[model samples]
Target chain A: MLIDTLITGLVAGGTYALVAMGLTIQFGISRIMNLAHGDTIIAACFASFVLFSVFGLSPILALMIVVPVGYVLSDAVYRIIMRPLVARAPNAGALEVDSILVTFGLLFVIQGVLLVAFGGNYTGYAFLNTPVDLFGTIVAANRLLALLLALVFGITLIFVLSRTRWGMTLRAVSIAPENAPLVGIDINRAARTAFALGGALAATAGVVVSMYQTFTATIGVIFTMKALIVVILGGKGSLTGALIGGLLLGLVETFVAAYIDPGLTLAATYAIFLLLLILRPTGFFGQAG
Target chain B: MNTTVAFILAAAALAGLAIAPLFLNAYGIGLLVGMTGYVVLASAWAMFSGPTRYVSLATVAFFGIGAYTVAVLSETLPYPLVLLCACAIGLTVALIVGLSTLRLAGIYFVIFTFGLAELIRQLVTWYEVNVTGTLGRYIFLPFEGIHIYWQLLALAAATLLLSWWINRSRLGLALRAVGDDEVVAAHAGINVSRAKLMLFALSATIITLVGAIQAPRWVYVEPAIVFNPTISFLTLIMALLGGATRLWGPALGAIPLFLLFEWLSANFPNYFSIILGVFFIGIVFFLPQGVLAKIEGLRRPARKAPPENKERSGAA
Candidate 1:
């Protein structure tokens, strides 16, 4: 039971980390905490669902189409709306809050549009009907595959952030944009790229989530909140932080539920989040300000 | 005399509310009461968002607290005392929370408050599950229907007065400074942290008072309903719709928008949320200054060029 639970927790945490990675990069590079991130995820989820229910395509194949569309949509949003704001010279907090407003406005639109397009019904995939026995306990094959996909994406994200020149430039901009421009970095373009990358991650998470559980249009708000918690817990700007935080949260929530009541799972998760904020405001692996 | 005028105005509003039930149908009365609660909640929402510029999604927390306080308190005490207790409970919790997080700035504050709200929701849900036998609690009040209108009206009036006082007070000035520039506000001799903490507590108190009234009015209290983000969303819409940094913006925004919502919901039914959501987004992006400012501009379109002295003073 413990092994099964631990594996399940890890898988869940891995998926969360995948979602948090997008948030981490956007916040770190652009200093924009995009609240509409989850709405886009919800949009992607519905997109996958529509592809599945209408065209009878497999979830994996649907993801390929949804991911690119998500990236393009987010890139367009950044170019059309957020780019103008980021181009301006203003207080960091003001700019960040504007991002929140812009993203929140987008959230409202996406949610409304989705509800209009598809009734508020839960959508899910039924690919893995049989559970595979791992050692002594039974686990779903899809869960394992989802975790593998998440791990692959997470590793790729880390590689991009750490190894690429563009990634280094993003870090430079995040650390000091004033200096980045002096060093010949196009801060606007970098920020826009980060936004697109984050959008792709959101869509990827959405598609994976649709594969795992049933979801509806209203899930956007809750998902956004959950992702925010993960972002904060993971150390606002650190992908490593997001991974650790997500895993910790997943394990903690699962253990808490296992020991206590399942109904209070959210409460326990929130409590730990509060504790983390009070104790280490910057987060576990976060660099010091 | 000023106090008397304020009192008379409040009384007149209450009187109008009392008669609203006689003319309107039950559904209309229900909608009015819900909107009143929302206005109160939204104004309380402004106490933090307006001055701090931190759009907290935690209005639901104190709202649930207020709702549950009423549910739990009305079992033992009178409705008025329960209402008072609810506000006190809300105030105390807000104070503790504010003190803990007031030192954090910008997004940190937002996260802290948001986390705290989610925590409260969890506790409420846990309580409902273990103790209350469900995920929600229902409040039963002796007097039903329009009889509660006076109470709601009184609550709204008190909220209006509180907002007015806050706007005119030194604390309000300090909060505004904090919102605009914390470093400058601190350097300029305002105890920025204390000011934020006070405002947080004050905002929670106002929201809780509204929750107290709402609990009895709805005759039901649930984790979902009380912790509903609708309170925060509507408050945000209202504050933004009326311009945040003003006294009467929330009321101006909430009252009319809610009326509009009533109209839409009555007519469209199914597509109500979709339409409302779209409209909200459109307004936010296009008119960050809010609909009220646009209306005000149109109504008074600088009829005559202001005197040079008046213009200078206004600029100053």
Candidate 2:
């Protein structure tokens, strides 16, 4: 039972890390909290569901369509909503508050649109239903597959962020936006790229989630909050911090569910989050303000 | 606007509302009750968030605690006493939370409050599950619609008066200074943390009273219902939509917003959320300063022409 719980917790944490990566990058670049990030994931899940149920396409195949669509949609949201707020704000602090409110508005808008389109039904795909044995513990094949994909994407993100010129530009923009422009890097283009990449990563996580879990339209906000907790716990802008934070949260939640009442899991998660905020606001890997 | 004139006008409006239920039917009274609740919530929210510049998403936490306190105490105590208990409970919890969280800046403060709210909500749910063996409790209150309406009106009036007083007080100046720049305020001999904590407790007290007043109308007290995120979002949106910076902004925003919500919910229930979502986004993008601010802006040049002399003198 302990081994199974450990495996399950690690896998869940891996998926959470995948989602947190997108939030970390977006926040690092634009300082927008992106409350709509989870809704974008929900949108991708719905896309995969529609494609699978109607056209008999696999969720993996649906990703090719969802990622680019997510990119465009997120970019449009940033341009139409966020850009105006940023332009109006007098300083970075004001911009942060404005962005949070604007993103919250975007969250409701996305959820409303999804509700209109899909109603409030829980949807999932029944793929890879076989059980697999891993070191004396039995697990679902789809969960393992989801974890594998999350890891692949997560590693690729780290690689790209560290090794590519585009990644360097993004890092520069995040660290010193004023200096990035002085160094001839087009800050706007880098920010736009960050949004697109963040959207794609969110969509990828969504596809993995849809393959393994059932979800409804309203569930998006909870996931967004959870992802935010992971990001904050891991240290806001650090990819490595996101990984560690996700794992810690997942383990705590899984253990609480196993030992205590399942209903108390969320409560326990939030309690830990609050304690962490009060005691160590910088999180595990974040720089002290 | 003269402070004394605004106070009188607000009192007169409250008096008019107090007598309105005598002629109106049950549906109108019910609508007025909801509007009054929003007025209290929005104004109290503006009181704290406006001057401190700390955007809190914890309204639901105090509100839920107040509601549950009423549910548990209404059977044993008189209604007025129960309301006071709710305020006490809210103040105690706010004091504890504020002390721990008041030192964080901006986004960190916002997230911590939000987390605290979610924590309280979950804890309440857990208690209900383990202790009560049911999701919620039903409370019985012996009050008519008019009586409840009057109580709500009184609460709303008190909130408005408190807001007006705060806007004109030395505390308000210190709070505004803290909002503008905390370090500067600290250097200028203001106890910034104490000011923030006091306002936080005061805001929570008002919100809790509003919840206690409205709890009987709900009939049932559930963690999910009382601690609903929608309440927090609505209060925040209404306050911002009316211009939180202004004393009367929340009332101006709440009346139209409550009416529109009523109309939309009754007519096109499925599309109501979508419309509201669109409205929220539109307001954020186009009317961030709120309707009151926009109106004030149009008349600012005329007002400022005379103020230029005062500004030069102040600068000199």
Candidate 3:
């Protein structure tokens, strides 16, 4: 029983970790806090739903197409919108509230567009119901696969961030963008790459998530809040922290629903976040300023 | 006090509103009420943002608190008493939250406020599910001669007057000082903390009153509408569009946009949100200072002295 629960918890945690990693990467590398990241995920989910539900394609193949499309859309947003913003305020320590607002506005625009196009209906795939029997328990194959992928992605992300030359340049740009330009690193190029990678991660998670639970356009708000809580709880710019926080949160929420009233789960999760903020604002692995 | 001018204008506006039911359709009246609520909420939001330069994204939290307070209390208490309860709750929450988070500067404050609002919203949803069983409380219309329309009008008037009074008060000067330069304000021996707390409380009170009026109009108060993220963003847009620093700016900004929203949502329905979001984003990127600033510049092109020059003259 415990193993089943742990496996279920880890799989759930993995999907959250994927979303959290997307958020943490942008936050760690560019400090943009891409509030619209989850919206992109929701949009991609709808796009994938169309491919599977309407066109009769396999969900896995649909994801292969949607992930790249998501990356391209995000890259366009970064170049046309965010790049100009950075150029306008080249010496700033952080992006302005206006930048946040613009991204947030984009979130609404994307959600509204999806809502109009698809109507508000929960979409899910049937083939994803393939389950793997472990002892007496049955776990969905996709959930297990997603969990394994998340672990592999998490370790790979940490390795890339900590080891690579591009990673070193990203850290420098984050620490000091103006000085980074002086050192011959192209700030715009780095930001675009970070946003594209972030977008792909979000879309991948979205595809996996839809396989587990049905989704609608309105799902974006709740998903965005969850991803944000995981990112914040894990600590800013810490990939390992994202995984740990996501796992802890997934367990807590799953247990909270199982034991206590399901209605209290959101409040409980939020309370934990508030406690974390009061106790350790920097998060578990985040450096103290 | 210019009581005569105030009374005459009040009487004219009230007379127009009272007769609105006679001339306009239910849709128009509904849209008007919504616009009025946004006006009060938006202007109250501006009171603090203009003076303190904080651009408080947490105004919705207080607004939600006030709304829920009214919704819960209206079940037991009179409507007027519900307003008082909401005001008190709003002020208390704002004071505690402001003191704890106000010290953070710039983007951190915005993030904190955003988190705070979301927390409160989640709490509200939990409370609604557990205590009220999802549907939540509804306000009954006009038990006596008093109607929702009149009550909403009164709240709007009170909000406008409060905003106007603050604009002329010493706290307003302190708030403006804090916005211009917090370090300088502290160096000048201004009670920066006290000034901000006061503005926070005042803004909460006004927005709470707006929420109080809003509860009865919908005849139902649910967590979703009370603590909606879009409503918070809309209020910010209204305040920015009109002019955050100026009195009546939010009203000027919100009234027209609210109408536009009503028109678009009614006609296009699905595409309205995309259009609104794009428009808001374009405005923010291109006009960071807002449309009101451009209008001010256009209205008094020659009268526009540089901010530094004005400061130097004022200092001398």
Candidate No. with top DockQ: 2
lDDT of each: 0.77, 0.82, 0.75
Q: Model 1 in CAPRI terms: which quality? A: acceptable
For model 2, residues B4-39, the per-residue Cα lDDT tens digits are 897688678778888989999999999988998998
- Model 1, C-alpha of B144: deviation from truth (Å): 3.3
Query: After superposition, which runs of candidate 2 have C-alpha atoms over 4 Å from their true positions?
Result: B115-117, B302-316
Candidate 1 chain A: 10-residue stretch with minimal lDDT: A84-93
- Model 3, stretches more than 4 Å misplaced? A1-4, A54-57, A90-94, B1-28, B53-55, B58-60, B105-109, B112-125, B128-134, B141-146, B168-170, B177-195, B299-316
| Tens-place lDDT digits, model 3, residues B1-316 | 4968987886798688767756667666677778778888888898887667675777778778877787777768877788888888888878766665565444445555665666777777776677867656776646322355566777777777887788788887877878767778889889887888888888878887777666666667777788877788789888878877777688888988888887897899889778978977886676555676667667886885443212211110
List iRMS for all predictions. 7.0, 7.0, 6.8
Query: For every candidate structure, what is the RMSD over all alpha carbons to the true structure, in angstroms?
Result: 4.1, 3.4, 4.2
Give the residue spans of candidate 1 off by over 4 A.
Answer: A87-89, B1-28, B115-118, B134-136, B292-316
Ranked by DockQ from best down, the candidates are 2, 1, 3
lDDT per residue for candidate 3 within A79-116, as digits (tens), equals 88887666654333325444666777788888889888
Candidate 2 docking quality: incorrect, acceptable, medium or high = acceptable
Q: Model 3 - which docking category? A: acceptable
Angstrom error at residue A95, model 1:
2.2
